[model samples]
Target chain A: MEQSSCTVVDAQETFSRAREQTLIESVKGGDTLAYHELYDAHVKRVYALCYRLTGDKALAEDATQEVFIQLWRKISNFTGQSRFSTWLHSVAANVTVSYMRKQRGWFQRMFSIDESEAQYHAAPADAHSIDLEALIVRLPERARMVFVLHAIEGYRHEDIASMLGMAVGSSKAQFHRARQLLKAWMGYDED
Target chain B: MTKTNFDDALKQQLDTLPEEKHPERDLWRGVALALENEADTSTAKPGWRSGWAAMAASVALIAMVSWYSLQQPSGPTEPSAITGEALVQALSQQHEQQKQALLVEYTDTPALADNWQQQLDELDDAAAAIKAALAEDPDNPALLRMLQNVYQQQITLIERVHAPKWQRI
Candidate 1:
């Protein structure tokens, strides 16, 4: 009975994967309906990533829209070497960072302005519902980005460094800074 | 909380973070509209050709303004005189009128980027800086050219962002 149940589960997984591949192929062939279906399946997760990365709802919405728009254009580039979700999340991260860079002034970008604390204080009342998330937003900008990308998004420190244009050491330092700040805010006793 | 306990608690909190978060607003309409516009722009050859033509015309206008400004007397002059200052004023007035018209025409159109106005303002600031430089060296062809390029960039940006749907089709 257990052996038969395992076989059934494996069959279901195969069927789901096949269906997703077909949907992706149709989207690549300029089928808007199929594209819409793909969007519906992935948008929530994409928005969640963008929201955490940006720490703002409106920016996240804009980033999510951009991600989908670019995804439609670049869907054909998916060689299927990795899972589609993984590829899409990578695309989302790159697009959100690029979008934010374009939105900032040259002076701000050059100086690497740390507005994370100010933004945290100004965070909407609704964001305070989650304790850790609120604290994450309060971290300094670089540290916050590193933490969200590493601790939350499961990216390697090297990947975070490349994405944010910082050294690997800087990425590690930022992550450490983020953890210390979060711990302090959470009232964790530090030795 | 002890360090070990804190680590565990933090890990738990991270684990509980939802994988999916629906946006407060339905974003499909905007995405669909942008995709449709992208398709239209790519398919419409005449519109693409006209975009290039418009850019060429702008370049020609800039040259004309620079030549005309060069013909006028250099150094401090009457406010109403047809010097570089007058040319700047004329260009600024024309740019403002065109911008306002574009804004009105695309009042309902969704902009592709949220910070386009801020970008335009930044370009305007660059233009102002060039104009200030021109004030010190009224006959400086380089300064005049730089100012013209900045203005051209502003016009291009505005048109690119708020381009009329009908025009593309």
Candidate 2:
């Protein structure tokens, strides 16, 4: 019975992938309806990544829109070397970062404004009830970005460094900083 | 929480994180609009080239308008000589004829921008405002100039977005 169930699961996975590949081909052929279907399939995952990276609902929404717009233009570039979800995530990360940079003022970009400290707000009524997502959002900008990219998104420190224009050491340090902050917010005792 | 316990808890939370999150509002509309705009432009020309063409057209229109304005009378004129209402009506008629001709010329060609109609509507609003101001000051050359400029912009926009690919070449 177990062996038969395993075979069924494998068969389902194969069917799902084949369907996705067909959908991708249809979208690349300039079928707007097929593109809409593709968007519906992946938008939630894209939106989640955007929201986690930006930590703002409205910014996430805008970034999601920009990502889809870019995807429509560049869908032909996907060679199917990797899973489509993986390619889409990379696109979302890059687009979100670029969108955030464009939203910043020239002065901020030029001056390299320090955003290392968390933006303060009233604490949750019960500290123990605070969720990990809330704590992640309270992290500083660079640390939050590094944490989301490296820890959650499973990007290597090297790739994170390149994406954020930082040294690998800096990316590692930011990840550590983010972990420490999250632990503290969660009421963990330091070793 | 102990360090070991915290590590375990963090790992569990990370593992359990939801893979999907839906936005409060539907974002498909904005994406569709943008894609439609891109398709409109990219079908006949590359997006970057279309952008450049639009910019060049704008500059040419500005230069022509400046040169023409320089040759015209600057001072206020008699209302009876050329009333603002009559000027608006004449310009509107000329604009409509030119617009129709351009539309017929490009009837088979796809537009270079999806929002061209929206842009025309916005220009129409501006012309109406200028018309209202001209009602109070029928002989204001400045008002007349503004009205003429708006009309010219409408015509320029139409010509730029609907220019056939052969002309671009």
Candidate 3:
């Protein structure tokens, strides 16, 4: 029965992929209805990613719009070498990171994590319950970017380094830095 | 409070993070308006290029028709030129006009990367620098490649936001 159920699940997944692929093709042809359907199917996941990366609700909203706009423009560039979800995640990451970087001034970026943290606008606090998304936003800029990408998004440190244009060591360092900061935020940095 | 280790707790929370989160607002309306605007602006082409644009359109139509027949019955398949239709037909004229339209449309759209305009301007400024260098050594292959790369980047920046395609897929 377990083996039969597994086969049924796999078949369902294959069916879903084929349907998604069809919808994607329709979207490529300027089919707004198809695009709308496609958007409906994926919007929440994309928005979540945007919010996680941008840290601000408004920015996430704008970035979400930009990601779909980009999708409308570059869906053709998606060769399907990767799953559509994976590919969209990559695009969302690029768009969100680029958006954040653009918000920062050239001189304010990444020479050191401490300096960037000073510029970072930490999230607002609550009296009793700490906010998860806000905690992420409160993280230092470089460390925040690294932590979100590495811990949450599952990107390798090397990949994070390349995306942020920092050394691989810097990416790893930022990840550790983020962990400590998050711990402190959670009232756990007892040492 | 139960003693949950920070790393373990955080890891578990992060791992269990849902794949989806509904935005507080509807974004489709904005996206739809943008798409509508692009289609309207493109169809209502600015004058000047309408001259040779006729020739370009004719060429693109013929190529698209050929490519369309070959496309799988599954929706709208990409044209023969996978990079783009213009790339497929080698119709630089049509591509240039489309590229310009996109550049104009996305001109005010803010780029999120730092020094976004500065970087684009730097690429443009490098064009002048290339021109000045060419005054000394006219046939340098490296400079030639740089010039091509710069133009391509400009198109990429523009199309990165507003390149349109036509197909069933």
lDDT of 2 at A71: 91
DockQ of 3: 0.21
Q: Please, what are the lDDT tens digits per residue for candidate 3 over residues B1-169?
A: 2235766767676777778989988787688668756655685422112312332343334434533454435555333423332232243354457657876777776432222354445555655555454445444334434445555655664543233221112
Candidate 3 docking band = incorrect
Clash totals in order: 0, 0, 8
Sort by lDDT, best first: what order?
2, 1, 3
Model 3 local distance difference test score = 0.66
The predicted structure with the larger lDDT, 1 or 2, is 2
Give the residue spans of candidate 1 off by over 4 A.
A1-9, A106-113, A118-130, B44-169
lDDT of 1 by residue, A32-123 (tens): 54566688889999999988887778988999999998888788899999999999999999988877777665248535666555433432
Looking at model 3 chain B, which ten-residue stretch has the lowest summed lDDT?
Answer: B160-169
Clashing residue pairs, candidate 3?
A25-B169, A26-B169, A101-B114, A102-B112, A102-B113, A102-B114, B76-B168, B76-B169
Interface root-mean-square deviation, candidate 3: 6.8
- All DockQ scores: 0.24, 0.25, 0.21
C-alpha TM-score for every candidate: 0.60, 0.62, 0.58
For candidate 3, the share of real interface contacts preserved is 0.53
User: Residue B13 of model 1: what lDDT?
Assistant: 84
